[model samples]
Every structure is written in C-alpha cells, then in structure tokens.
Target: MGREAVIVGVGDLPLNGGRIVGGGSILQVQARAAKAALDDARIPMSDVDGLLVAGLWGVPGPGLLPSVTLGEYLGIHPRFADSTNIGGAAFEAHVAHAAMAIEMGYCDVALIVYGSNQKSERSRTLGGRPPILTMQFENVWGIPQPVGGYALAARRHMHEFGTTEEQLAEIAVATRGWAALNPAATMRDPITIDDVMNSTPISDPLKLLDCCLVTDGAGAIVMTTADNARAHGSTITHIRGYGEAHTHWSIGAMPDLARLTAAEMASRRAFEMAGITHDAIDLVECYDSFTITVLMTLEALGFCKPGEGGAFVSGQRTAPGGEFPMNTNGGGLSYCHPGMYGIFLLIEAVRQLRGEAGARQVQNVETALVHGTGGTLSSGATVILANN
Candidate 1:
C-alpha cells in the first residue's frame, strides 16, 4: 500500500475525427487506443488488472456500467473497475482514483481511457447529453448551455475584474498557434484577437473562435506501481500529486461565476501534495472548453492572481516559444474535443513529460501540471506529474 504510482504508457488513435470517413464505432476506437497504450508500455493485454473508463457510447440507461461494457470489449476482467463519470474531468479523477487504488493494493496495473464520436453523430446543441438531473432545470430555459454558462463566467470576470474580450482572445489565439505545430490538431490555422472577436458570436462576448471544437477523439493511459514500471523498463512519468473536486452541477448554483472555486481546491491539494510551488511547474495542460476556461483556470490554479489572468496571458505568453508553455497539444480548443476532453489533457501532459510530443514538445520539461474542468465549470481534477 506504500507503492508509488507512475504512468508507463500513453496512446491515441490517429485523429480521424473519431469516426472514419463513413463508419467506425466508438468501441473499436476505444479498444485500439487501449491496445496502443498497452503496447507502448510493453505490457500484454492479459497483464492489466484494473480498468477505468468514461464515454457516451451507449443508450438505454445510457452510459450505465461503462466499465462493464468496455471490459467485455477488451476482454479485460479487471479486479478493480471504476466508471465514475464527472464529465470532461472524469479521466483526471480516474488518474487520482487509479493511483490510490494501486497504492492501496486494490489493483496493480490500471488503464484509464475515453472515446467519443460526438462530431460524427451527436448534436452540439446538447453536447451529446440528455437533460437529466440539474440539466432539466437548465435546458428548459432555452439557454445555450455549456457555452452560455462559460460566457456568463467570462462576462462576470469582465465586470468584476476588468478582463477584456481581447484578453480572452489571447488564449484562443495562443492555443491556435500551438495547434499550428500539432500534426493532429483539428484547427491548425493561426488566428488573431480580431479573428476571435469577429468570429460568429455564440453567447454574449463569446465568439465561435473562443469555443472548443466538436470532434471525435479517443485516448488512453497505462499506470502501475513504480516497481512494475521499472520492471518493464518503461520510461515513467510519476504521479507526484493529484486532487479532484466539484462545486455545482448547474451553472445557476455556482456561488460566483467569475471564480472557479473547484479548480482552486483541487490544484491547491495537488500542489500541496507535490510539495512544490507554481514556479516548479515546467508547463501546464488544462481543459480549454472555452477561452474563458483557460483564464479562469490560470487564476484558480494560482499561476496568477485571480484578476491577473488577463494580463498574464497577453502577447501569446502561452503559445510556442513563450515564457510559459501550455496546452501544447493545442488543447480542446484546437485539438479534438470528443465529448469529454479531460483524457486528452492527461495524454498530452504525459507526452510532454516524456519528451515524446515531437514538434510540440516543451523543452527540458521535468514537471508538468495537468488540470481539467467539467460540467459548467462545475468540476475540477488536478494532477501534478514529474519525470525527474
């Protein structure tokens, strides 16, 4: 139970918009991603004893028993199985859960995976979810959810902190710049603040460019005890620290729209466990469902003061060659955002830590912080990773 948790392998299907030109099932993609990760770790499929998954690949009770469904597909009979779904941040929380499970002797090796074909099939109006639970209260109002909620946060930030539309645009533009270097990013063209401002408006002060892409995507991660990783001779990214928390399911219930309270709690716990300050972080990989998400996360994660996020990201500071590197896989804004985007954030962080990201790799990265926000900024999961 005192074992250290470490990531040994990560994998992704070649981004083809999640679905092929015509047909391919989410199950196939998920299986393939799992295989890729296992192969990368040099671990046979038969070796995995734990499974964690999240997705929207079924109906009728919908995603109920996702681990059971995916376990059957991969022929993995995991002793430790978890299918906790906290929206986009689910995978990040899975890492936390898997690490705890492995350390507690509940499981030796764990695979955390996710896949979504939202772009190929589901409607963006609902972001591939039915109005269940608190959503019933939200969807009935005719408010374009998700984006509308983020827009509310953005507008509130501007009102209380004097953040500007141009500042929000800085995030989109910088992330797009990083996308230009990513071979698999869906949106590679470089964009400007004016472009973000002029792009079709979705909600007040939130333009099309400020929003994330709707695309099919799949990714997987393989984690195990440090002994197992060293036994397999796998290059490792150690799970130095991890934390997760959620505030409210509905945007209406959020105490403060301008502040991402969940992110603060999660990242604070993560940093505390890692015994490191913000300066020790080499880079960041965060959920960028909207441009506002990056700004709010930066504040919540303590990269900058709550109101200083606007200035901190100015001049494309997070873009390639900037003092800080973030969302190097282009983030959900430019990278593929298949339904839940948190899995991709973890994958990218692992890749950067391993120096395997090729063109988008951050140089000499010893440690990276990965943060994910889910729901209407309702959930947060932070993982501090290290390869040093």
Candidate 2:
C-alpha cells in the first residue's frame, strides 16, 4: 500500500487585540495551541513522533535550535524535528516536510506549530532591519518598510497591467466582508473601495486598510498516517499535494517588480502533483499580507492571466456568494496577522474542508488550495487539500 498523510486536528490560539499590553509569551502561546491540537485529535502528547516549529528570527531565546528547545519545553522528545524558517511560508513548508517524513517511515504522527507575540512584545515591528548582510545595502535606499516594498510592486503592476488602487481595495473589502461573518476577526466592520481609498495612506499605492492587522496569535495542526487518522475518528483532511518555491530574499533584489514568479512555480507544481486543474479548486485560502499580495498571488496561481488580476478581482468576485470564494476566515488582512500568517492559512483551509466554517462556510467544499507568501513576495508555498 502507498503511504499517505492526513490532517487529523487543527487548533488556533486566541488572538490578542492589536498592540495589546499583556499577553502570554511565544512559548506559552505555542504550548496552549499544541495542547489544543492534541485534544482535538484525541491523541496523547507522547504519540507525536515528529515536531516542527516555526522560528522567530529577531526574538530572543534558543536561536540556533528552536525546534529542540520547543520540544524540550513541551516535554515530548520526537524522533524527527525541523525548524525551516522561510518567513511566513514556513508553516506550509513544514506541512510538506512533515508529510514527507511520515511517508518515509521516519514518523507516524507530526505536529506543526507556530506562535508570536509581535504585537504585544515587539509592538508589531516585524519587518524592522534584522542586522543582516542585505540590510547594509538595502536600508540605505530608504525603502518604506514592508509597506513601501509592496507599494513598489503595486506601482509596477499598475503601470504594466493597468491594475488600479480601486482594484486593490476590492480585495480588502471582500476580505473584510468575510471578517463580518467571523466573530473572532479583529476588524469586522465592512469596508468599501471608497473607505479603503480614504483611509490613511501608509505608502503611495497602499493605504492603511490595505495592510494586514498586527496581532499576537498562534496555531497548530496534527498530521498522521491515513490509517491512524481513521483510527482517531477525527475529521480527516487529506494532503493531496504540495509544492514550494523561492526567488529573492530582499525586495531590492527582486528580479521582476510586477510579478511573483515563485507563486506561479509553486502553484503549478502543486496542481500537477494533485492531478487537478485550476478550475477544480473549490475554495482558496491565501496569505494576504497586503492587498497587492493577494492580487499578485491570484495572477501567479493561474486564476487569471498575468496582467488580469485587477479585472479578475473586480465586481467583488472573491466576496461572499462570489464565484471564487477566497479567504473565508477574513484572511490576515481582516483577521490576526502575527509575525507569520501561513499557519492561519492551514487552519482556515482545514476548517472549510471539514465543513466547520459556520456562517462563512462554502457549500460542499471538496478541495481547497492553501498558498502562502513569505518575505517581500520572495518565497511561496502551495498545498492542495481534499476531504475524502
């Protein structure tokens, strides 16, 4: 029999309000999320044979061996451990890694976890200079933080593809509409294109509303062999296929300003591996670090032509009752975006596949595409999940 992996459980920690004062540390948040996942799966902590943790770059602690430290803290010595830090896409990559590990007889069960107190501890300065070698050259140019980098991409996309700021606002408005259905979302108030345009401008082509919220949050997911998932009597979301790709690290080093080639490569590979076409996907859960990110991702993922993202998202195509239901959990733009938003993407995908999305649920979702973008559109990971 061929080996296969299935997600047996998923859990999300409570999101702290934006810039809130008091909240648990990263370790505490991760532990709680892990416990929740274990409980949800009806599995004991000792049953987890693999552990994968997302590393926070600037945060203090066991910098070199974050996964080992987290394992020790959680009191579960796993046979397999990984700490692959590719920015926000780390979690999605971890899912791929965990599935491969399980298929290779390295582990029977795996737990992928992430947690961050960026809003409470760091005041949401996640994209600050990291004292890296690239910063020496890039910082001198006075790049306008992360927002500025995204604005540059937005500008280039607009110039080449005729993408407008109003089109970008459509993404935020549609995502916010989903937020209104989610009580846990940070920004539930519905927004319009005019409201997004009138909001405070953080960058030339990007407004405050276009940016994702800064909040402290954590999430975890449990993946096990398909047979084990059946034994647990849990809602099984099968890992049909996955693929990852990366381009440049720094925004200045990006080869193309208007396009995210990594997303294109990743999504194409995932769809091919899953043996499905773009039209077969019932829903999408993509990282929305900014409105531009979502738009560019849609184009790169083959939802539309290279320069047709603006028109593809027009007329509230991604909103509730729209043809393409996306970001049904409000996305990072309206929900909580800690340092890493990839884990939340998996959580929401699982919810939608399990038919647990409540008011925002898409009817009869059999397949979902979860994509994550990290860095300044530098890295991308795509996972195709199905409920069988």
Candidate 3:
C-alpha cells in the first residue's frame, strides 16, 4: 500500500452462444476487451507501459509466453510484463502484482486482460493435470476431473457439518434468481431447490444445476496510480487491499477436504489490510465454479463460521434483496464461465462499486470484496475495493 493503485477502466465482451460473434480467435477477443478497456479509460495504447495476459484455454498452438505474445499482438512495448497462471485466481493476483509494480515504479499504467473460447473450441473438459502436477494417481483411479474432486469436498462437508443437499440447492436457486435479473446471464430462468435436486447429477451430491455454466467470454481491467487515474478524469475504484494463498495443486494432496484453507488465509490478510470487518463489505463477488465453492468461500471468508454456510445461504440471503448480496451478476453458476472465472468476478465487483450495475446493482455500495479460487480449490486470492 505504498503508492495507491486504482482501477480506471473495465471492459467485457458480449457473450454469444459460447463464442465471440464474428468468428474471432482467443487473441481477437482479448484484443477487443483490451481496446474497450483503453477506450473506457480514455488512455491511448501508447500510454500503457505494462501488460499482463491470462493464458488462453484453447490456443491453437503451444506458447510458453502469453504476455509477450499479447504485448506483441497489441503492439505495446511494455516496461513490465507478466503471465501469472494460477488458474481462476490469476487475474486477481495480476491486480496485486500490477499494483506493486506501479508502487515500485516498474510501470505507470498496467493492463490486465483475459479471454477464452473454451465452449466454442469444445474445450470444456480442459482441466486435467498441469505440468506441475506429477501425481497421476487420481487419474489412474478415475476421479472424473474437477467435478469429482469438488463432489468429494462437498460430500465431506455434508458429513462433517450436516450440510444437506437441499442447502446446496438453495445456493443454486438463489444464484439463478439473480441471473433472472441480469440480461447478459446465460440461464436467466428462475429455479427452485426442487429444480436443482431433480436436475441431472454430474457427480454424487452435485446436480447439473449445482455446476457452473460453460460459456465463452472475455473481460479486461486497467490499473494505474491513483494520481494518474485522477489526472485522466476517471471515476476510479481504489484497490484498498489484496492477498493470495495456495495450499496444494492436486485434490489427492489436499490436507483438508472439508475446507478451503487458502480462502481463510487470503481473506484474513485482505480484511486486515483493508481494516474492515465482514459487515463493512457491501457486496461480495466470489468465484463460483460450483455451488459448493460459493458456500465454502463464504465460510472461509468469515461471513459465517465453518459448516454454517448451509444455513447462511438457505433463505436467499445472497439473492437480490438479501442481507449479503453475493455474486450479484449471477456468478459463474448462471453467468458466463469461460474456463477461468476470476476476471469476471473483478468485472462484476467494479461495476457494483461504480453503481453501473443496473437492475442487479447493490444500493449504496461503498466497498466490495472479490475472491477467486483456482485449480480444484488449490489456490485463492482476495481483493478489497472501495469507491471512496
């Protein structure tokens, strides 16, 4: 928190049929989002001296350096460049990195960009094992990818805390309720707990409705020094605090199956840095890869005690008019989930803080908390933003 970093611009491409309309590659959508961000900031590409790009899910060829590729594509000679690949939490981590870079005088203006064509490329089943993950034991035992890993966690939570399937269904139902208010949501129809329970079961205790949507989309954000943002005449959201933590990569290696330890550590650091309690937050933009993810995150973030997430979200507390408005833009469950969902969380949080979230807007939003979980709940990052 040396020199304050503020987000001056945010942009999101229109999600269409799990694809970017007009037949564009992952780079094309990324460029489009980047251009939109630049336009929103009223800053020329020449002014951007830093670049960070998330690794695309369905790139045509194997590339080791995504940030370099993007910088070359965008024709920007950035003084600072980074390609941090922590799955869904990458974007949030990028924000932190960009802030530090600006504070340390590594760069003045930084652009963080992400885009994915997972659905269009039929790459929905892309979460296998990363090169860093050498343990193939789970694969040999037929663990059925992320759905099965998350199902195992969900089942354990149910056993340890008496978290019922109905409680889990409540999360999906409430999120869909919010989605109904969002015009860009993929599935806007209101659903019930019965609808969730009756839906197709992907894994044991996790119905199809419990799972997040698979759609193609892109999002971007521009970060710079607070003085720079003010000089540009931009309505900026200050990055008050941020933190990150990682426990393990593989599900088999996870020390605790019933909880997300990283969320606890990261959120604590963020809250302490921001000097605010859970009650001080007006809204939460949590990465909802699945219904259980949101539930576990709420518990880990101290909104409720461990094992109390079921009761916390039971009566639509996270829905439109709930006491705690969470995932107000439908979240990954109903909103677009194009592989990595961290960027969208930032986008929604920024919109809410700016009072630009029409319909789904949370009233009198002074501060918002955004968190992301990546790689089978292996990694986590928390960011606190305030309009003041």
The lDDT for every candidate, in the order shown, is 0.89, 0.88, 0.88
lDDT of 1 by residue, 28-47 (tens): 87888899899999888898
For 97-201, candidate 3 gives per-residue lDDT tens digits of 998899898999999999887788776665555434455566767676788889999999999999999999988988888888888888898999899999998
Q: Which model, 1 or 3, shows the larger lDDT? A: 1
**Which ten contiguous residues of candidate 3 have the minimum total lDDT?**
126-135
* lDDT tens readout by residue for model 2, 197-221: 9999888889999999888788899
TM-score of each: 0.96, 0.97, 0.97
Q: Per-residue error at 216 for model 3, in Å?
A: 0.4
Model 1 clash pairs are none
Better of 1 and 2 by lDDT: 1
- The whole-model C-alpha lDDT of candidate 1 against the native structure comes to 0.89
lDDT of 2 at 319: 97
Backbone Cα, N, C clashes tallied per candidate: 0, 0, 0
